[model samples]
Target: MNASDRTPADLLSSALAADPGRPLVTFYDDATGERVELSVATFANWVAKTANLLQDELSVEPGDRVALLLPAHWQTAVWLLACASVGVIADVAGDPAAADVAVSGPEPESLQAARACSGARIALALRPLGGRFPQVPEGFTDYAVEVPGQGDRFVPYAPVDPEEPGLIVAGREFSGAEVVERARAEAPELGLTGPGARILSALPYDTWEGLNAGLYGPLATDGSVVLCRNLDRLPGETVDQRIETERVTATAR
Candidate 1:
């Protein structure tokens, strides 16, 4: 299916329909020794709950810009799809002051930027299991606290037009259609072709190239991602070990 009938959310739905048991995202944080693997159904469940949270709690609707101040984690991937599911623009590089909502990591910088958001500010602890921050920041709502209460199945309040702008990845904008088109092109570029292809990517999530590999590339091809943060900290032997352990077929460093 092409962009004419499918959005990124649709692609995910197809993946779930085809093989919900397959792993979609495998995340590793070298800094914290954390590893998380999410299957298509599991990831979709997280996305559904998150989408519900965005729609019901945050009052986010179509065309609303959400500043994503998170990192290269599984939850960030969930939020990206959640935003797409609700027709909200996921702005990875947006200014907090200009955004209607901001979802942030637990870093001081992210917390500070999220606090500056004029609209709803949400903080994610990014712990092993989406744990809440030890000391919740005053200006931000804890995502771990709010998301669990949201419905597991999400239905958008308004239908998302495929031509509507859906993502502001870095400084560039992509409509829902464009995102699917670009993913088709970028998937082969990132060697994320073939069924169940696994890519081990060490790139951060702040740029288009990173986002393409992390989210769109694999999803476009029914492939999976082993996203690595702080790659340089790992020894070369450890990297090789990961390639074997994670069953990675390609490397995108």
Candidate 2:
């Protein structure tokens, strides 16, 4: 059950087995004053449903490329794991035109970019409580609307190979095994030295460093992350207060 030699999906399964109720991802949107927390069980459930949606509804096969044109939101984190579970290569902030599937946020720029994808297109409203968009975007399935109808459990039709490409961030491709290895390697440097280390990250998800700090590093250590978006909008005092309130032991900014 150790994450050292396993894929991201295996790591998640191990985390769920270790403690389903433990908080895994705690997200904050400083601009919108939004905060949402997901326990390991809840996060895994979302990943399963999203993986089912990708596999059953979208018909995504192993090695398919999925462009993730989203920010560092909680739902975005779920999508990363779902892509891993379904054996799809997640291209974060990649060109939608070249992808087999594209996932976009509700922002106008992301929506505009997602329209180029000839394959399946999905959109997230990124609303509190995972609410659906008031009006679904053109040619895009609403994730919040579709995911809930999917089954709670997921099993990939094709087993995920750890050596297969799993993630692409900033145009750097990494296999499923490399993703886990990189996460583990970056954990200590990112101050995720021990289990239960709470890390507060203000970095964007577009870079390897950001992904490591915001998602993978903490996960590798069986720790939790306080992921912040638009953190620069908040005052220094407010940010400090949040660190104290969240019991953050480390910072990656």
Candidate 3:
């Protein structure tokens, strides 16, 4: 699809319809030595709910930035898709202050900023950040529990304009239009599509390569994207398990 026409939501919907049963994301937690799998259909539902919560509870409007400090968990995927569905700008940061809403994980720099910036209204965490990372302080709304039952379905706030920025990648910025353009330009050489094709990537969602190539690009072409949580904790076996278990067809770096 052309850059002007394609959107992150369009790509996600395509995957949900084409392979509702297929594993869309597999997150391996080394500390717990467990795997969490999310199928396209289930993920879509969660994303919808998340979108509604952000809109209704937090009043996150289109183009508003939500910063993510979480790991490569299934929740992170859901958050990204949800933000895209509602036309909110998902600004993933290593530091939290740069974001409007903060999703805490291993990093806390951005979370601190989110608090200092005064724009941060909501904070989401898969687990408490007592010691795992810096605390988001008190008074900030905890999105983990508050968001689950807020919305039954996702309502599109606005049709995504590719020219508008969909996500903040790396330390730089890129618009949705840029991502679709890059995907189309590189798809032929990268071999980024086709049946049974899966992409395994260690890149963080905060990076351009990860957001475009790792997540959205693969989804656009009916391929699965495997996001690894701990890139440093590896014996190659973990990667092998994901490949063997998920039947990953390809990898990008």
Candidate 4:
């Protein structure tokens, strides 16, 4: 399939093939004193492994709802793309009880939701690196434990149709093709131009603007994102410093 006909998964693959070494995601969490940068190839590898865990380990099928009760972090971005790759519908911060599988962070709400889900549950430690949870949450598998052993290359067992459901956020569901079209349609207003557009954003994932920063914008423009968690805590000077350091071209506050 050509670039326009391909899904988000295909967009990522094209980006990787075009420039594997370019930075795709630069993440920072001031609360945890954490910073991580992943290039196209590395991020794609993470998506591959996570997708494998979902399909091979959890037996998640196409059209399955995967609740992502996680905050705005790099791993959360990985999960979003992984779900899209495998044709699983990503429910960002949605109710886990209605989902087929739930991936949560180290938050009470996420924990409670994971426990309530009827299917497999996975909890992320949200450590500086991909570390195992110091104390595993009851009734949920630790994400770090299961992700590493999986293959770095992913080949889906079944085809993921672009017209199928791809994401659900804020009670709104969008198909894979619609997600791309909307992103592309909204790109200019969001300051996402052509290649190499770098946006540094400090927005929560529960809102539509936040999802653009975390997922759609960069994908639409073949650009990069510097995602900040707990950005409200940082000083203006520090934020400016990061903007300079990261070579950010735009900001979404």
Please provide, for model 2 over 160-219, each residue's C-alpha lDDT reduced to its tens digit, 9 standing for 90 to 100. 999999999997999999989989987888989888899999998999999889888888
In candidate 3, which residue ranges exceed 4 Å CA deviation? Answer: 1-5, 94-99, 106-110, 127-137, 188-191
Residue pairs clashing, model 4: none
* Candidate with the larger TM-score of 2 and 4: 2
Residues 1-253, candidate 1: write the lDDT tens digits.
Answer: 3344457888888888889999999999999999999999999999999999999988988999999998888999999999999999999958988899998888888788777788999989998978888888888888998999889898897888889999987689999889888888878778877888999988888898898888888998889999998889989999999999999998889
TM values, all candidates: 0.97, 0.98, 0.82, 0.97
| Best-matching candidate per TM-score | 2
Off by over 4 Å in 2: 1-5
The regions of model 1 sitting more than 4 angstroms off are 1-5
RMSD to the hidden true structure, all candidates: 1.2, 1.0, 3.7, 1.4
- Candidate 1: Cα lDDT at 236: 99
What is candidate 4's CA lDDT for residue 240?
Answer: 94
Instruction: Give lDDT: candidate 2, residue 109.
Output: 93
Error of 4 at 205 (Å): 1.2
Rank all candidate structures by their TM-score, best first, as comma-separated numbers.
2, 1, 4, 3
- Per-candidate clashes come to 0, 0, 8, 0
Candidate 2, TM-score vs. the true structure?
Answer: 0.98
- Candidate 3, which ten residues in sequence have the lowest lDDT sum? 128-137
Full-model lDDT for every candidate: 0.89, 0.93, 0.67, 0.88
* lDDT for each residue of candidate 3 in 195-232, tens digit (9 for 90 to 100): 55677777766666666556666666666677666756
